[model samples]
Target: MSTLVAERQLVADACRVLAARGLADGFLGHVSLRVDDERLLVRCRGPQERGLRWTTPEDVHLVTLDGEPGDDGELGEWAPPNELPLHAEVLRTRPEVSAVVHAHPPAVVTADLAGLAVRPVVGAFDMPGTKLAAGGVPVYPRGVLVRDRRLAAEMVAAMGNRPVVLLRGHGLTSAGASVPEAVLHALSVDRLARLELAVVSAGGTLVDLPAEDMAELPDLGAGFNHATAWRHELANLP
Candidate 1:
C-alpha cells in the first residue's frame, strides 16, 4: 500500500483496537496521525456511523491542522472529531511525536475519579508500564471538551514531556512516534488503572515494587513493546 493508504489503515485499526480493548466506548473517541507539518489523517464519523468497533479505513479523513478537510472534500457527510485540537496542539508542540490517541477508557476514568493514580504497583506485571507509572503520570484538571486551541494547550502543559496525560474525568491523550506506540501507551495506562481498581476493590493495598527491582527492569525497546504488542492486539480483535 502507498504511505497514505497505510496511515489511514493504521488510524482506523488503532481506533478498532482501542474499541475492542474497552478503551473507547461508542463513537466518541479519535485517533490521529501527523500527515506532515500542516495536515493529518484522523478518524471521522462517516455517514454509516457504526462507532469505533466498526471503524474501517474509509472512515479516516485527511485534514489540515485547523480541522479542514483536504481539497477533495473527501470528508463528505462527516467531519473531523470535535476534539481535533487535542491532537493538533500535541503534534504542533511535540515535534518528535507523529501520532496521538484520545480515548475514554472506563477504568482509567473511574480510577482517577476515585483518586487512585496509577503507580508502580508491580515490577513483573508490565515492565514498560511500571516504568511509565514510576515516572509519574500527570493529570489535566479539566473535564470539559477540549475543542479549542487554548484548552488543548492547557492539556499539553499538564502533559509536559510524558508519553501519556490523564484528562481528569474525561479520558487520556497518549503521544508516540508511531500509531502503534501511541495506542500502546493508552493500553498500558488503562491496564494499570484496571489493576489498581481491582486491587483496591479486593481490599489489598498497592505496594510499589522496591526501588532496586524497578531499577533492574530492562528497556525492552520499541520492537517488543510496540510492534509485538500491537500484533497481539490485532490478532485478538474480533
Candidate 2:
C-alpha cells in the first residue's frame, strides 16, 4: 500500500480500537494523523454513518489542516467530524505530533467532575502511563462542540505542550507521534480514571506514587511502549 493508504488504515483501525476499548460511543470521537505540513488523514463520516465501531478505510478521508477536502476538492456525501478544528489546529501548531486521538471515555469525565485529577498514582501497574501522568495533564474547561477555528485554538492553548487534555464535561484529547501511541495515551488515562473511581467509590483516597519510586521508572523507549503495545491492541480487537 502507498503511504496514504497505510495512514488511512491506521486511522480506521485506531477508531475501532477506541470503540472496542470503550473510549467512544455511537458516531462520536475521531482519530487523525498529519499527512504533511498541509494535509492530514482523518476519519470522516460516510453516508452510512454507522459510528466508530464500524469504521473502515472508506470512512477515512484526506483533508487539509485548514479543513478543506483533499486535492480532489470533494469527499462526496462523507463529512468530517464536527470537531475537525480540534485536530486541525493541533497539527498546525505541534510539529512534533504526527497523530491525535480524541475520545469520550466515561470514567475520565466522571473522574474530572469529581475533582480527581490524573496523577502518577501507580508505580509498577504501568510504566509509560506512570511517566505520562508525572508530566501533568491539562484540562480544557469547556464542553462546547469545538467546531470552529477560534474554539479549537483555545483548546490547543489549554492543552499547551502536554500529551493529553481533559475536556471538562466532554471528553479527552490525546496526542502522540503515531496512531498507536496516541490511542495508548487515551487507554492509559482511561485506566487511571477507572482506578480512581473504584478507589473513591470504595472509600479510599487518591495518592501519588512515591517520589523515590517514580524517580526509578525507566524510559522503556518507543519499541516496547508504542510499537509492541499497538500490536497487542490490534490483536485484542473483536
Candidate 3:
C-alpha cells in the first residue's frame, strides 16, 4: 500500500528468496532496505527464530543509519543482527544504495578460501556471473565477522564502487538501489562461485570472457531477473 510497507515486504521477500536459494544458512545472514537517507528496515531475528526461510514482514525492524531502533520501545524482544554496522555504514556512505544483503553462501566462502577467482565462463547462460566479472568484484580479505564500525568501515572501503564484495573466508555483501537488485546480486555471486568451484574440481581449465566480450553483455538493469526469481521462490515457499 504505502512505500514503506512495500519496502518492508520487499525485504522480507528477499530473505525468503535468500533461504530458498540456499544463499543463507540458519540465521547467519541479513537483508536491509534503505527507508530514507536517515533510516532503514532490516531483518531482525531473535535466538528463537533460527532461520530466514520462514521470515515474514513482522520480522523486519526499522532502525536509523546509526543503528538505533525506530521506536526504542517497540522492538520489544527483537534484536538486530550484530553486523548492523555493515548495513548502516554502507547505506550511510553509498547514497545510491537502497538495499544491502550480507550472506554466507557456502560456494562463495569455499571459492574464496581456495583462492579461486569467480570469472565469466558461461557468458549469457548466467547473467549474474557475466555482470559480476564486468563490474570486477572485490574481496574484503577478512575472515572475521563484521561486528563493529571499524571492521564495517574496512569492508566498505574494500567494496569501493563495486556492488558485491567477497569477505575472504566469511561470506559476501551485495548492494543495490532496490531489494530485488541486491538479492539478485547475492544469488548471482553464489551461482558464480559454485560454477567456479565445479570447474576446478572437475579438472577443467577455466577461461574467462575477454574484456571486450564482457562489455558486449547487457547490464542487469534495474532489478534484472529478480522479479522472476522472486515469483518462483515465493510460489514454492513453505
| Highest lDDT model number | 1
Candidate 3 structure quality by residue, lDDT tens digits, 48-122: 696888887778888887768776564667888899999999998899999999998999999889988767777
Give candidate 3's TM-score.
0.91
Error of 2 at 211 (Å): 0.8
Model 3, residue 160: what's the lDDT? Answer: 98
Give lDDT per model, in order: 0.92, 0.90, 0.83
Q: Which ten residues in a row have the lowest lDDT in candidate 3?
A: 219-228
Candidate 2's residue-wise lDDT over 182-228, tens digit each?
99999999999899899999999889999999988887889998899
- Give me the displacement of residue 197 in model 2, in angstroms: 0.7
Q: Which stretches of candidate 3 lie over 4 Å from their true place?
A: 1-3, 219-224
Query: Candidate 1, 111: how far from true, in Å?
Result: 0.5
Q: lDDT tens string, model 1, 29-102?
A: 99999988999999987887989999988889888999887657567888899999999999999999999999
* TM-scores of all candidate predictions against the true structure: 0.97, 0.97, 0.91
lDDT of 1 at 22: 95
lDDT of 3: 0.83
For candidate 2, the per-residue lDDT at 237 reads: 81
Cα lDDT of candidate 2 equals: 0.90
